[model samples]
Target: MATNQDKNHPQLKFETKNNTVNKLITVAYFITIKYNPDHFLTMFKKLYNKDQLYLIYIDHTCSIEVKNMIQTYIVHLSNVYILDSFYLQTDSHNKYKIQLNAMQYLLNVSAKWDYYINLTDDHYPLKSQYRICEYLSNNKEHNYFIYYDKSRYDLDTYNSNKYNYSGLIALKEATFSESRIIPYMSNTWLILTRDSCAFLSYSKQVDHYIELYSKSLLPSNSFFATILLNSDYKRIIINHDQRILFSKSEPIELILKKIKSNNHFFIRKMNLTSNSIIDKCIEDNYQLPLMDKKENKNELGLNNNQQN
Candidate 1:
């Protein structure tokens, strides 16, 4: 039943008009070598509407067929773009480089957008796009970067003794160098402001950290967090990303509870099975237990016009 058009093109039609309910959201979708182009096309269809823009990064390690498919199908859409391919290495320093390259590309081409969110194909939005943007627009000043000080632990001794193997053995893994400005770091799934995007793109401090952590494992986790923490934006950081999971042990019911509770906007590491569940939940208008929300007086003025 697959027509030639169906075989070659995505099922959903891409939209161009900008009718977003809140601020424009620019999403960076980083695709690894093994990502299914067809599945991605399906997800893209769901995520990209008139209001949002998608910048997709396909790694050089992806097959020629995959690359061709992305070029032929995904890029032709009005809102989707392809960043220059970089080598995506596993358990290596170059893994971080892959992310940074995509980030730089996104920053260079994006002229305007309120929030920049990094995503992989596995992430699914728990709320409608409107709700996601409205929530962020309401809290526009906060940087959704989860940060924690690591200097308290003896990382060097742990690294030397091989107690908790992270499976990220690269050129060399060492303790946090005393030279590091701050002891805070986390993975790169961040939803930060345009100002933070510009800062990461152009800041000399970030460049220094990039070079310093080039030899470290998965520096994307540390590079941006370290720089943002040391910069003037430190106080605005919320130390949490609603989209990420702290552990796989967190029960699915607990996760669904959180989503119903309206404590999170989106979640990551989803596959076909959970994706179906999420789609159904959203469709049925399910409501999780409500968590207490503390409104900031300063954030109240962020979208005051919405009040009137």
Candidate 2:
């Protein structure tokens, strides 16, 4: 009973055998209105491993048939959970709340994980689960995020002509705030530490701040970054999310070049209609050595720790 996907990509059947790393990572995947369910399923199948947990959230606008299809695809996987449908508006103005809700849910359900990563359904892994786990394990305490500093750029760059505030004002407001806490620009996807998630989930100040900005535009983009950068976790922020590459569809050659040069672990907005892109990515990534052993030892300062 092998399906077209199963027959075409036999390696997916051996995800566990291929992923020998032991570190645990949790993922929260948010789906937009336009994603292909089949592509999303393929992405999950490729990244699946016993050491990780995957939470999927579908936009409320999607039809019940779509949800049922997603449910059927992932129902058999013990590690994958489908969240209740929520109004995940694609409008830039209304996106913050949905992202926050997904984050809040992940934090509540899987607080024990070492690291948690957020991704959109359009994203696909550039590296295998073992490689991603190895990278995170080597930098156990560091959080990966991309943020812009106000010193180099003006605060007004992220704001509107009508209003300007010092911090997140509301989820849909047109103004931008220069947070003394930590002024950062907008990039939603990030990887954070478990403790950071706990702080965001439980901190009274964070709760109050979020309440104030509940109506603010893109609050999720800045709220967590502001909290982490303004707090004790500030120094540990890595300022880079290695899992994603932002370029739109370029030839595979250029993408490969970027991967080697930048150490990217994933890329987004790939063509869902074709498997050639993912096939090439997997072939190239699998041939590359897992994170450099010596660098892991020197960077993490472990005594000959072995990854199976």
For each candidate, give its TM-score against the true structure. Answer: 0.73, 0.74
Can you tell me which runs of candidate 1 are displaced by over 4 Å?
Answer: 1-11, 14-36, 90-92, 154-180, 233-235, 244-250, 274-279, 285-308
Task: Give a tens-digit lDDT track for model 1, residues 1-308.
Answer: 01133345555564323324543354444444345556676556556665566677766667888888767765445556676654554334565566566566666666666677766656655555666666676666676766665555434312232455554432223535444355464676677777777777777767776666655544655667666665543236665676635235777676555666676656666554545655565444323322335532212123322110
How big is the RMSD of model 2? 7.8
* Candidate 2 Cα deviation (angstroms), residue 40: 0.2
How accurate locally, in lDDT, is each candidate? Answer: 0.56, 0.58
Task: Give lDDT: candidate 1, residue 305.
Answer: 25
Looking at model 2, the pairs that clash are 170-215, 170-216, 171-215, 171-216, 171-217, 172-215, 172-216, 172-217
Question: Global lDDT for candidate 2?
Answer: 0.58
How well does candidate 1 match the true structure in TM-score terms? 0.73
